[model samples]
Each structure stands twice: as C-alpha cells, then as structure tokens.
Target: MTRLRWCLLAIATLLASVLAVPPASAAQDPAPILDPIPDDPAPSGLGLVLQEVARLPKSEPSAPPTDPRLVRWNRINHVGELPDGSGRLYVPDLNGKLYFLDKKTRTPSVYLDVKATFDPDFFSAAGLGQGFGFVAFHPDFKRNGKFYTAHVEAGNALTTKTPDLTPQPKTGFHGVIDEWTATDPKAGTFSGTHREILRIGFSGRIHNVQQIDFNPNARRGDADYGKLYLAVGDGGNGNVGDNGGDPQNLAVPQGKILRIDPSGTNSANGKYGIPADNPFAGQAGKVGEIYAYGMRDPHRFSWDTGGSHRMFLAHIGEHEIESIHQIDAGSNLGWSEREGAFTFRKDDRCHLYPLPADDAKYGYDYPVAAYDHDPPANWDCASDTGHAISGGYVYRGKLPALRGKYLFTDIVDGRLFYTNEREMKQDPTGQKRAQIYQLAAYDTAGNPVTMKQLAGDNRVDLRYGSDAKGELYLLAKANGKIWKIVGTKQYAGCKPGPKRVSHVAAAKNWAPVTPSKWRFPGREVILAEEGVQRPGPRRPFEYAVLKSGPVFASARIDAEVRLDTPVEISNRDVIIVFGYRDDTHFYYAHLSSDNTIYPHNGIFVVNGADRLRIDQQWNANRSHGAPPAITDEKWHGVRVTHCAGTGEIAVYVDGGARPVMTALDTTFGSGRVGFGSFDNIGRLRDLTVRGTPAE
Candidate 1:
C-alpha cells in the first residue's frame, strides 16, 4: 500500500477504537478522554473568562509620574494566597509594592511596601522583569509568621568581581531573598525583621532570583517541609551582552534551583540550613545548595502537590523553542550548552547546537514539552506559539474535566494550553504526543476572546495563580487583570452519570437508615441527626463504622465532610475506615492531619486493636506538605480506592485525578468501611462505598 493509504488506515482504526465507546456510558468511567488533537485547535474566538481583581497603586510624584513605569499599570507579576487562610489574594507588581485584595469585597490594599523598605535605586533597572521578583509565605506562616521575598537590592556586597572585564562588584547589583516575620499575621503588615536568606549577584538585571516558594502541603516530617525552593536566572547582563557562566557554574547561585531550610541554621554563615538530601549536598567542589543546575531563567515552577509531587518549570528559550521541564533533584538542564531540547550557542547566528552522539553522558535534562517559534525562514515575529512561556499548576480543582491537566500559557501572546501530565512525560517529543491547545476564553456575549484580547493587548505578560482550593487564575500584567478560570461543567462526551453507584450527599434522604450502617457508639456520635453526621468529636479512637452488610476486596469509597470548628493538628484527624475484617482488624486513613511517622497523612491497619501505619513510604519525612484542610467548613470531596489483587490503596481529595496518598500492601484482604475523626467536630455526609461483592 502507498504511504497515504497506510496513514488513512491508521486513522480509521484509531477512530473506530474511540468511537466504539457509547457516549452515554463514557461519563461513568473514572477517567476522561481528551481530544488528542482537535480538528480546529484554534477554533474561532475564546473559551475562558478573565475578571480584573484590582489595579496597581499609582506612581509616586517623586518619580517620572508620566512614564508608564511609574504607573506600573499593567505589570502585575504574581498572585498567591496568604498563609493566614483569610482566602485573600496577594499580588506583586514589578515596581515594588505588594498588594493584597480581598476577593469577596473586591477591595485592594497594599500589604507590604518593598520599595519603601529597600533602596529602590538598586532595583531601578529599566527592564520590565527587574525589581521585586516574587514572594512566598512559609508553610508554617500561619503559626510562625515567617515569609520570604525575592527582590533586587542596591548593594553589590554579595557579588564577586569576575577578574577580567570591569569586575562585577562595580557593575552588578544583587538579587536577595530576605526572610521577614509578622508579629500579628492578621494585622496586614510585616515586622521589620528582614533576615537575609540568600542573594544572587548580577552584572545586568534581567534574570535575578525569580521565585521563592515552600511546598504548602508540606508538614514537619516531610522531606520538603519547611524547605524553600528558589529559582535564579543566569545573571544576564544585557547591557554588555551575556556575562554568562553562572548557569553552568556550581559555586554561584545564579542559573540554578536552590533548596534550603528557611528556618534552620546549617550554612557556613549560619543563616539557612542546607537540606541534607539536596542533589549537590556534600559533593566535592560544588555548591551544596544546588538542587538542579544549568538553567538560563526558570521564571516560574510549581510542585504538583495533588499528583506525584513532581515539579514543572517553564524556562524561556533563547532563539527558537520555548520549553517546559519536569525537574529531578540533580538534573542538569543544559542552558548555555542547549536550549529547550535544542543546541544553543551564544555566538552562532543560526544558533543550533548539534546533539552529541553520547548525549546521555552529558547528564542533561531536556524539556518534556516545547513549542517552536514562528517565521521559520528567519526568527522574526512571534509565531503561533508565544515568545515567553509561563508555568502553571496541575488542575486539581472542582472542574472535573480539567483534573490532572497541567495548564501553562505564553507570556507574550497569552495563549493558554493544557496537556495531560502523564501523556507529556510518556511522549517527550510532543509531536505525536499532542500539540498544545489554545484555550479559548469567552465573554458574557458568547464572543470568543483571545487571551491577548482578554488582556486588551498582545503583551499579556500572562502569569498563573492557584488558590488554596487549587482553583487557578491567570494574571495579565499588561492589562492589570486577574482571570479566574472557569471550565465548562459538562465536558463534551464526559459528563458523569446521574444515578451514581457512589452517590453521596449531606441530606436526609442520604442518611444512614440501619444500625449496621452506622454501628459505632460514642458521646459525640450524631450520625445524621440534624442534616449532618458527627461520627464523634475529634478525639482518640472515636470511630463510627458501617457494620451493615456489604464487604469487598476492592472498593471505592467517597464522603463529603465539613469542619464545624478549627483543626488542632495535635488532636485532629478525618479518618476513613476501610478493609475491616473485624472490630480490631481494619485499615483506616488519617485524611488531613499530621502524625510523626507519616507527617502529611497515611493509612493505618489495625490488627487486634493494635494500629500500625501500612503506608510508611508515604508517611512523615517521606511526603510533602501538610494534610488537606478537612475542617475548613467548605464541603470537601474525599475518595479512597483499594484493590486487593494489586494490594494498592489510593486516596484522592476534591475529585482530583491524582492520588494524594498511595501505597501497596497485602496485609489485610477485605472488610467493612466507615468514617470518623480524632478530637474535632465535623459533619459528614454521602458516605457511599462501592466494590465487588464478597464471596
């Protein structure tokens, strides 16, 4: 057969396989199928909505007020939630002011003024990416009131001259990550502590320290808990061309991702502690702080807390391809040597570095996803793919269709793309894997608006943010707007069925009817009494078991819970009991509390009234982030799946595809399932559990 005929046959076969599934039943499946390549990838207009949150503060009179820089009108860079759990949004402008907006009231206020505290002259570069870079609240910020900020500082004190061309000490400034504390976190202001955590010096000011963040879910015992990850650029001195050597150099902090304990003192200067597990720690002749190296400018990166804790970073490419990478601890992201899976050379006009025959020996970490620039003949205008790439989160929000999709966008063109995280890793070439989709954002009029159009300009400078609930937002620096992403509820051909085998609700019709359904007795046991069920107050061993009839070896259990009061970590737990063989033998999971062994949370098996954590690999010091906040009053979706055949147990929250906790153990075969808590008052509803019938 001819090549064309063979291709046609292949397409027909794929179509048959996909179209064979009935649309009515497809929605019942646990996973959703995405259009690998939509026929009209850039169909007509838009599909998303952008709502402006707040505008930046007006420029001061002392500066050139008329200049656009003074207005900082459209330069909103980053957005995050405060640790106080107030649910307010915090935004940083490149001009040096930290603005906080209470989304509920739609009011914006200055939370902290970095320019006023630091010498603005040091960060007074004309570039758009300069000045105050980013801020991250410590994981324990709620309790410790500690936070860190990355900004440009005036002094070259931390910089060492490069020996040859007009020593950098005289020509460069510094990028500093300063730790600050708030005596009263609710006061909306920071205490003037200002402890210097780390600093990167630059000959020119484009790629300074870009971001500082801690794993929000990290608990005390997790490896990543209290560890701050900082990304630095190659100290690009645009004034004199690239004064480059930092990305590949280990001694300097620039062009690398550094992980340090913000609260511990183990450094030579005793400011911060070097994580013992860092990739370069204890290595000879290398900086112990380096987590990964050889990066030009890793502008933005986020941890996939809802999934595998893998980090995805969006690195700006040099001339041709913009790239995205999933980094490993000691991974070497080739920068000066390569760019976005392509060879990169500063001096080469048609810059292309030939891949070495023995590339594996180089220990280079190539981008998992990338898009080439337009104007193939000569690099000219922005191609269909935008110029700069912006990193985003793995969508684990309430949007069922978007679950597990890694969302990213172009800073210049403002085109947002969502790719299957698993697929991206499986097919790194990204050719057959799946080309990035231009997420269509629409307005109330049903008119499709380009991301650039939403920002009212081509220079969107798009950035992404995720609230505590994992809902994502897009920040348009050029338009000075924040867009909350709202996905279509009923996904095409993937809407969940109405009569769920696992339907749960907090209403009367769904209440437990028999003694066997809710068979535990305790003082706080109000199982579905007043429109809700309290298995027991948060206390030790207070459990309400569903001792009714059904039992299974493999099962899927889902429950909706609401915390009536605050959660005290030391004495609070939302436990889901499963695989119960008897009263003294069963498996239960602490869904949202930290314990010493599995700091974040884990599953424990009770044998003869003796409880032992079965999933130690996912326990404390092994996991990242604190447990999910189970007592926040908002209805939280909890799911537990166990397959005895594979001895695999997985847990999910908020309908996220990614399992927050997982383990494989065959200690117990099958039994009953139930729900309860430790020392906290919470309401539970929709306790629906389904599995194959027991023999």
Candidate 2:
C-alpha cells in the first residue's frame, strides 16, 4: 500500500483505543502501586452536615498580643461533658477561662476562670496549646465533686516553684496538673479549691502537656476506672539534634502516656499514685508512671466505647507524617527513630526509609491510619500541608450513618477523614494500612464547603469533641465557633463524566512552540530535536497546544506517549499540557523515568510567573516524591483530568485506578490541550480529549 494509505488505516485503529474502555482481557494488568491517599478522594454515599451550635465569647490573651493569630479572639482548645448530670457541655479556651454551655440552649457561661481560680501566671500564652490545656471530670463527679485540669506556667513559676517530679531537667516552662474539689456538686459555677497533683519542666513553650482524660469505657468497679492518662509531648526536645533520644528514653515522662490515680498518694511526690499495672511501673531505670513511650506529640486520645473499647491516639508528626495509632500497655510509637511505619533519621529530615530487617524485634507499634503532608501545591502561603491530626471518636450515637466509623481531622487544614473501626487495626506482618476516606462536610443550608472555607482562614486550628452520648462536635480557633454533626447528607463530590468528542489525527491539530524542531510524520507528533533551554523552575522548553478542538472549561485527555531518547539516558521526559491560555500559563505533567528530582517526574503549572509544582506527590525537600513518570522507551497509556470549577487536577498512568500526580488550581481555565517534551525528543499518538466546551 502507498505510505499515505497506510497512515490512514493506522489512524483508524488508534482512535478506537484512545478514548474507549477496552475489554478486561485485552492484556495483563500492570503491577500494583502503593498509594496512601487514593486518586479518588471524593466522598460518596453519606456525608455529614455541620450546624453552628455556639458562638463562644472571646477571652482576652494573658500577654500583650504581638500577632492576631497568636492571640485569636477565642482559643477554644477542647469540648466534652463533665459527667455531672447537668445536661451541659464544657469547653476550655487557651486564653484562660473554662466555659460551660447548656446543650439545649447552646448558651455559654464561665465555668472556671483559670487565671482567677489559680493565678495569672498559670495562663501561658506562649503557645496555642499551652494555657488551660485540658480538663477531665471524675467518673463520680455528682458525688465527689472532683475534676482534673492541666495548664502551663512560665516566668516566676519556673524559678520559685519546683516540678512535682524531682531531679528533672531545668527548663523554660512547667506543665502543671491540678485536682479541684467543687464546693457543691450541683453548682452552676466552680467555687472550689484546687491542689497541685503533678508538674514537669519542659524544654520549650511548644508541645507541652496536651491532654489528660479517664477511660470512660472502664466501669466504676474496674481496675482501670478513675486512672487518668496524661499525654506529654517531647517538649520540642526530639526535634533538636542530640536530644532526639528523649522521647524513646523511658526514664523521663516528657514523651509518654502516664497512667496515675488521682486519689491515691503513693507517687514519688506523694501526690498521685502510679498504677502498678503500668508496663514500666516496676522497671528499674524506667519511670513508674509511663504507660507508653516514644511519641512526638500524642495530641489527643480517645477510647471507642463499642468495639473492643480500643484506645487510639493521634500523634502530630514533625516532618511529613500525621498519624493515628492504637495504644496498648507498653506500646512504643517510634518518633524521632520512626515516623509512621517508615524509618527516620534526624540527619535526613526530608525522606523516609524502609524499616530495618530487625524492625519486628523492636516491638514498635505503627500507625493503623496515617497521611503525609501533601507538599504545598502552589508553593504559596495560601495553603498548608496537612498539620496536626485532631483525634476523635468512633461514633456510637443515634446517627446510624456515622456509627462504626472513626472520625478525625487535620487540625490546620480542617480536612475531615475516617476509617472503619474494624479496619483500624495494626497488621502484625506490617504489610497493610487501614483504608482512610474523606468525609465530606456541608453547611447548615446543605451547601458543600470545607472547614477552611467556613472558618475563613488558611489555618483552621480545628479540634474535635464528643459529649457523654458520643455525638461529635467540631471546634475551630479561627472563628471561635462550635459546630455539631446534626444529620447526614449525600456527599456532592466530583462526578465528572466528560463526554468524549475530540481526537487528533493530522498536523493541523497541534500548534508547536518551536515549529522548526518538530515534524508531523503520518499520525504522530515527533519532536525531531530538543527545544531551546529556558530559565525557570518547572516550565518546559518546547511544547504544543491542541488548538483545533473546542474550547474546554474542564477536560480529560488520554494519549500514548514514547520517549524518543535512548533508555539509558537519565532525566528523559515528555510533558502533557492543558488549560493553556498562552505559552507561560498552563498545567503540564512532566512524564520522566527519573523518580529522584524535585523538578522532574511530576506535575507543573505556569501562571504569569515561573512554573510551580502543584502535584499531590511532590516532596519539596526530597526527590522521592512520586513514582517514575515512565521507566522505558516503550509506549504507555496516560490520562489527565482537570476540573476548572473545583480546581481539581489528577494524572493517572497505565490506566491505574489511582492518580500518581494530583493538584488543585483554577489559574487558567477554558484553554487548549496537547503534548510535547521539555528538552528531550518524544512521540505522541492516539490522542483523544473529552471535555465540556466553554460557553
């Protein structure tokens, strides 16, 4: 056949495979890829609605505010019931006061003024989680009229007063826990006397004592009943080079969960009793009160009342991981030594390594549910990588839709997530992770929104709460507002079903940046030579836009790409472009064989400024962000989806169910789409795009 006639027959075969779903038996499946955050994060089925239950009164900061965010209008840190049978809920504002609100009326009043109840020095504003740290009432609060609280103190308290635990580090601040007796059990306000039960010095103002709570699952007659668990962080000591051993050292209480009896007086200081059942209670060189060790910040912990009554703690990670782990006696969650299940070395803060072969012998429990910080997509201050896991409860409430799922949040981003109670268990073989899914949030009017949008701040500073009945509440420091999970709504997540309508077959379909370096041979786009070098971060040197098709507001593009460069060459790549307003403004997926380079093997976008990486899997400090874009010279299937309305972008390789590269941006919508290489030669064929045309 003639060359022209042969090309026409090949083009007919290419169009059929580009946009259609082939039969399952078409070929063998590719190797399975490991992804912690799935490509499809949009929630399906039932979602939750948030209703404004209370607008908390603002408490003045103890110190002069140098920054508004440092001293928010109200710094509400926690919410829970006191078990006092008052049908009331209590929340503590880090600024100073503890407020109580009638659940029915949703009106709040001062329960106890920590600055007034103790001293002004007791209310530390040095950090957000410092003052009025946490509160826990006695299981029999209606009779004993007793409760517990934790707070931080600076200045004179660090010099004049001594920590309850003697022979400790001389530090900058003190974490104090006090036991208070109410004058009347049924009183509306606290008119009581408090005595110091425990105190420890901390290395810095941040990551001090975060929480103190009792096991609600333990009955009154149970041995575990009334034992208070204190979550003390590493006092910012672990982040410092040599002091990384502090959290793993059992001798100190700095990075441990300590179980103590509030009424007994057998501790070293004769204030609280150290439970003999504690794993290290009788160990020679270990602190008798340490229940579990090796945690950076055991920010918040809770017990699921229904299933095995398992206790879980949400640990805020330093560099990348934010995780949730199931806690048991003597459990050690490796911190500076391990972040999540991966090996961590203080010298290399940017990467995670596989655990050593003898990892099982160390008896370190890993996270059942975890997520790493998705690198700052826009490289701007407007967004934050996930920060601080706000631990929450496994719902046992009347809402059937929410029950059995353990709900939680990223405190900074206010992103809500959940995992099944049964699936949230550690794998003895360390080969599996619990499936975590996003739980969509909606406004009271049933309009979908994010916690960050509702709070109107980049840093939501979100926290979770549960009343005695197990219903959940979401509190944000940004707005000083409390929202309750009132009912269920169907999550209105991205259901993009773009209609396939366009394909490329001839030279007229593409507009190349450097026409001299490219040639259209038959049905393929061939970059015969490398394009000109450019001075920018992630922008490519040469590329082409599919200018002949309909204008698209959002699109899903598919193509078969092959690197024309030799397989032995490193950094060989082909970039696929979309949303192209001009040469400098568009999004591109840098498909390359190299997995170890910040600027290669992921997604990039240029909007008037130099190109910036906005992919979900691009690590800023390290190179091992995403998998290799392509590892060989052979042709492979590629897919790119962009939704302009929601600013969601995803890239799938080899027809994988999950995207290896994803991003969110709406910079240049309603543009064109095409493919080319940054500096290397490549070939593109079987091109197809399905999208909604812009009006």
Candidate 3:
C-alpha cells in the first residue's frame, strides 16, 4: 500500500468497471414499415450534403529522428470551449476524471467517473474528492445536451472513524452542483442523465465553489438561457464567518456569487430556479440565489470579449490587497469591509461600510486591476508570498495585433502583465508600463514563487481560455499549454542576413508584415516564408526568428511561446518549439547559429536513455528566487536542427507544446538562419527548413 496508494487502488478499480453501464434511451414506440407516395408537385429543389474525399501526397520532407516516445500527463485541472467547437479538458485527479479533449487531435477521452456517479458511501463518507468547477455548457448546448458540474464530494459516514455522531450524509455535501444530460453532443461517451443540482457545504479545506460560468449576456430564447455564474470562496482559513458578509444570512452560503436557474420550476426548494432577474428576487427574505456579494477568495472570473456587459473578478487577499472587480446585479464587494482600494480590519472593532458612492457609479464595482502589500513598490510582498490575484482576459479576438490588451497574472509571482483601461486609471502611483514577459507565466498559487536570475521550475496553473473567435486563452496552469493572441509589424531596420530566412514568404495574406532590417550583429537570423497562417482567434501571419547576444535570445511565430525565464548555454546546441500556455507552464521556440532566441527557459528536451531536465522558471519571490536573466525589454526563442545520424530538437510556442529534444551529437553543423531583435521589440511567423541535406 503505497506507490501513491497503489495508484489509488488501481484508479478505484478502473472507475468500478466504467460505472456498470446502463444508459441509452430515445423513447420506445419503434417501427416504420410503409409505402405512401403522393403529390410529386414537380417544383422542389434543395439538396447538398457532399461527403467523400481522398487527396494525399504533398507532405514530403521527413528526416525521421524526432519521436523519442514522448510522455507527459500532469493531468488537466480545467479547460473549456465546447459550444460545438469542441475541447473540454478537466481532470481533478484522485480518480475524479471528466476528460473529453479532441479539438481535432489533442486526444483525451474519459468523460466522467467520480466512482461511477456516487455512493460507495461516495468514497467512504467524504475522503476521496477531486473535480473543482467549470463544465456548464448549455446555450441549448447543441440542442439540449445540457451539462453542468462543480464536484468535491466524499463519504464514509463522514470519517473520523464514524459512528454516526451526526456523521456526514446530510445529502453528503462538500460541494456538489451536478446536472448532466449529454447522450451525445456529437458523441465521445458519457451516456448522461444524472441530476442533483445544488448542495454546498464545507467547514474548511479551502474556497470550494471554484467555477460555473455561462452568461455571455445570455439570451437566445431567454429564460436566462441556462443561467449559472457561481464562484464562491471564503470558506477556508482567513476569518470572516459570523455569517461572512451577511447577505442577510441563510445559514451560510459562504461569501457568495451563485445565480441558479437550472431550467426553472424550483424542485421543492433547490435544484435551481431563483432568477426573477435575481437581485434578491422579491427581497423581504432574500436568498433568491444571490448574484453578487462581498467575496474574499473568488479566484477567477471573466466575460468581456467586447460586447461589454462587462464582468471580471479575481479577489483573494488576507494581508494587504490583491484585486480586480467590476460585476453587478446585486453587487456588494468590499469583503471584510474593503481590501483593495484600501481599508481592511482598519482598527478592528468591526462595523464598517461605504460603497455605492459612484463605487464605479452605483452597483458597487472597483478594481479594474490592483496590487499592494506595502513596498518600494513590490518588494516581493515582504514575506508570506503566496496566492493573490489570478484572473485575466480582455483582448477581444482577431489580434489587430493584440487589440486592447488586458491579460493578468500572479499566482505566486508568475507575473506577466498588460494594462489598458487608460493604463488602468493613469497608473495610480503604481507606475504605468506593461509589455512585460518572462516566458509567459504560470504557477497555480499553492505557494511557489522564486526568481531573481530565472533558472527553471514549474507547478503550472494559469487556467482560463476562450476561442471560436471570442479569442482569449491562457492555460499553462503548469503545462497543458494553449496560447492565442497575436499581432506583428514592428521590426526596426531588419538586416540580419541568412537571406532574412527568405522573407518568410509574406505569411499568406493575414497581412501586417514587417522586417526590412534592424540592429543585427548576428549569430543567425532567418525569416523566410510559405503560406504561413498560424496566429488565431482566427488566423493571421507574420514572421520572426530572432536573437541578440549579451543575453536576449528570441523566437516568434505568434500562436505560442511562453517560458517564464531561465537559460544557460555553457556548451551550445539548443533547440525550441513550445506549448502549454497553461496547466502550470512551458513556452519556447528558440535556436541559434545566426539568430533565433526565445528563451524564457532555454527550451529543454534531454533523455539520452535517461537524463531528464526540462527548464523554465521565474518568480518574484518564494523560498529564495533567481533565474530570469533579464535584458531590458525582454523577448526570446532560438532553434537548432540537424538530421541523419539521429538528432532532433525543438521548442516552438506562442502558447505551448512542440517540445522535442533528443541527442546523438550534431552540435549544430553549418549555420545561418535569421532574425535577431536582441535590442528588444519582436514578431515573426512560419519560417521553414527541413532535414538539411544538399550541402
């Protein structure tokens, strides 16, 4: 017993034989038999369903040597986008599965498993939990495939060696939100139908509620189109109870954000309803499923792809502030009596109040972005540097080259910033300047932050995404990588030879090109092109593959490249190609010889039988930090490839994954690539070169 509890008792005996099977019903009364042909009114035409294809040939250029078996499964924690566009990712381990992934071939599968739905005492009365928020769906989720989830449940009569001293099972709460249905939203597997809508209960063990979402302004046939919104948090250690922020209390719902409406008709008091436009429905006795209220650990929240009904929260503070608010409907925010724009436990004695004075004009809302902990401006929050601020989004789609920038971070110094509400209200003494980067940040706040010279390390957790045109995506919560936000055309005077990598063939018209020549003292630089097309929220193109010694290496092809920071050459021979804009972290695509630097952590790929060392780490503070080798205005990526006799290396990214590092000994023979903005500012696209043979 041990090996992680024998892999958790063989994944709880393979999820109890895949939940013992049962589903599949489309209603009885089957049968068709018949022949009735009438009225061929000779005036009808409307048919087109084509399906038949076979065209394969042009994809040559394959010097083999690039497969090293690859294996990485840190297991997902959160991932989305499935309004039909596909892609669902969620794996709160402890055998709590949900999977799905396949936005084409990201390959995943599982579907659902919490011990086959529930009741082995649900895991010995509350003791095997996992699965925290984000599933929702239901905009008619492709014609009623429904969908909902908010997990965290266990059982064993409730533990403590039980004996019914009021032992668990008051419906076994520890946070539950269920809903399910999916008999087939284009099929993958999870023969749906389950029910249990709301349950909330947790005396400790951190925040709990986690996420829910679904209300991008909602509408299409209304009725709150599946209204949800949740968020919770403030149940763990950080004092507040006494009925927390009292929304008039209802025996505690913990610091609130709810919303409900799961289809309506309130089933005898809970299973969803409360939505007469919410805001205390009929007042008098409140709790109509709260919409907003003072929060103390709200984690993450978003909605603002431009349509602007605006929404964005990310509270979480205990010592000094760390905020980002603006969300209404019943608004209250100002937990423990304000902690962001200032004033917290101010002289204790309780009794504090003051919101609604244009608190962002009416319904309470302040913090388009915040940061504080006393300092010469951020001396690593002085001490206790863990968890505070991790909510991001705002760069509405089609990268008009990063239109409107907003992004956000700080799950323990994975600091990556970007501002724009007019530099966040003219920089409130916090100085205005953002375009900062150190391998695109990630470290899900479990306490981990250290970096002064940036070496390499990660626990990844930058979770949050959106695509299918609404743009936004940043999920390197520790390496599930997926970044999308692009823009280019900023080269200074380009002229770092290798034929400028053949002018990167103009990146296929998504247009916005640049590169005529800039400060290039070269090590290798290229930017050639051929039908590029990668950037997305929808697709665009440019070209970049730069580097500039003194310590500023680089790489840029947009769509992916985030490595937080740390690079050591020592003996040369590096490569790049990255992905994992979230799931912890990993982002790069760097190479060298003439120019190709994108080093947030010199993209790793070692394992010549067994050497394992995949670099990238940068923190602002935590158990002594270092390894982000700064170089003024930072930007990095470098690449190296040599075929035959076995050698393949890679690190390409704008978001994550392309990592492939193997070795036999080729130490980059014959140089000359292109692009090097070592002076700062960068951009690039598709530049290609394969197998290298003709001299």
Q: Which candidate is the best by TM-score?
A: 2
Better of 2 and 3 by lDDT: 2
Instruction: Report every candidate's CA lDDT.
Output: 0.64, 0.80, 0.43
Kindly list the per-residue Cα lDDT of model 3 for residues 227-318, writing each as its tens digit.
Answer: 88888665553244433443224324566787878888662344567778877766654566778877767877877656454777777766
The alpha-carbon deviation from the true structure for residue 362 of candidate 2, after best TM-score superposition, in angstroms, is 6.2
> What clash count does candidate 2 reach?
0
How does residue 369 of candidate 1 score in lDDT? 70
Q: List the lowest-lDDT window of 10 residues for candidate 1.
A: 489-498
Q: Native-vs-model 3 lDDT?
A: 0.43
lDDT of 2 by residue, 532-579 (tens): 777654478888787776778778888889898998888899999888
- Model 3: residue 61 alpha-carbon error in angstroms: 65
For model 1, how does the per-residue alpha-carbon lDDT over 54-77 read when each residue is reduced to its tens digit?
565543322343335334344668
Worst 10 residues of 2 by lDDT: 32-41
Score residue 56 of candidate 1 by CA lDDT: 55
Candidate 1 error regions (>4 Å): 1-46, 59-74, 120-122, 155-171, 237-243, 376-386, 426-434, 489-695
Q: How would the candidate models be sorted by lDDT, starting from the highest?
A: 2, 1, 3
